[model samples]
Target: LGNVRGKDWRIQTNVYGNGSTTRGREERYLVPFDPTEEPHRYSILWTPDYIIFYIDDVPIREVVRSDAMGGDFPSKPMSVYATIWDGSSWATSYGRIKINYKYAPYVSEFSDLVLRGCRVGPIQQVDSADRCAEAVEELMSADYALLTPRKRAAMRRFRERYTIYSFCYDQHRYGNVTFPDCDYVSSEHSRFGEWGDNKFPPKEVRRARRRSRKPSAVDDQPSK
Candidate 1:
């Protein structure tokens, strides 16, 4: 097979035997039994740019030409040929498909051979549009307001781990100051409410105040 993008090509064949002029591009060979033994059929289909050989309806060889590698590959007419020959050296090494020594000057039979023209279409492209659309839809439906503290912590962890520079903080919609960089605002030494320019206390401070009122460690814990 030849790549439609003109990237690769291959050749295959089976024509073995002694005294065979099998040189250059001759890859394989096979011998058949003498005439009078069950006669076998072999055929070749040639197009404007390719040649395909078949044995009893089973494809055995394919030859694609260099000129047929591009978009306008050969889609024209062609012919076929079959003849018996002494292919001893190549055939013996490759093993014989059929032996025809009994009928000296072995007459290889060729009947019911046919040639037909065919048209093949181009390959289809992968469709990623639907998958992309679905992903965008999911992102749009995500509830930034209802995001739990645990989720926020996870996002923070991810951003820190990946060294991300840009992220969305929905504090403005929740009556809290939105800091462009949370890393610069959160400090281990300062009390939660006293950090940066935040007036309503940081998220940690609100959680601490709520915990002081309820006196529950579970309440202080980030919700999943």
Candidate 2:
């Protein structure tokens, strides 16, 4: 699966393996600020145990690998890429909203690149995983790889305020079939309707949230 923006400009993180069309999952969220207005940090951290997606240093989503997941979790060498294109077919409103070329030359700039990993020639080599063992250990021990208690709380608050969709909780789409890696949280689950869409938080809760954080719920209007 690929990361893409929605018709309403919300960002989405997607993951899939062993046939994406049948087993892919996605999470959608709205950033606090206008991404187009300024440069912000976007990052993806993938390890053998878990994968984390971040925006401006804030951990937005994490997928923890589990034995029950089987081959659903991505477990192979991969390359990183960044680009901008018209994915009107599925990027926005399920293709109902086409990319209007009137605004030509849509540009996305990436810089100050940082990649951490052991380099190996090819996956066919039998010792590829063995050779990368040391690097994987070092990578897993890094500050970014481990989520502290404070960071976990931040992630929870961000999701409570900004998360719009989650495949793990989509009862209507996959009734009685919970994703193996899903860590069910009753409070979080209650926030989502049966269809997996977030039911807008109550007025009092929104007000309280606004008073507590810089990011307001007003900016989290879910896409139609």
Q: What is the TM-score of each candidate against the true structure?
A: 0.28, 0.80
lDDT of 1 by residue, 24-134 (tens): 223321221211324445555544334455433334434454532332233332224656565543233223333446646644455665433332223423334454455
- Using alpha carbons, what is the TM-score of model 2? 0.80
lDDT of 2 by residue, 103-150 (tens): 777778788888888765555533367888999999999888888876
lDDT score for candidate 2 against the true structure: 0.70
**Candidate with the greatest TM-score versus the true structure:** 2
Name the 10 consecutive residues with the lowest summed lDDT in model 2. Answer: 213-222
Cα RMSD to the true fold for all candidates: 32.2, 6.1
Instruction: Tell me the lDDT of candidate 1.
Output: 0.33
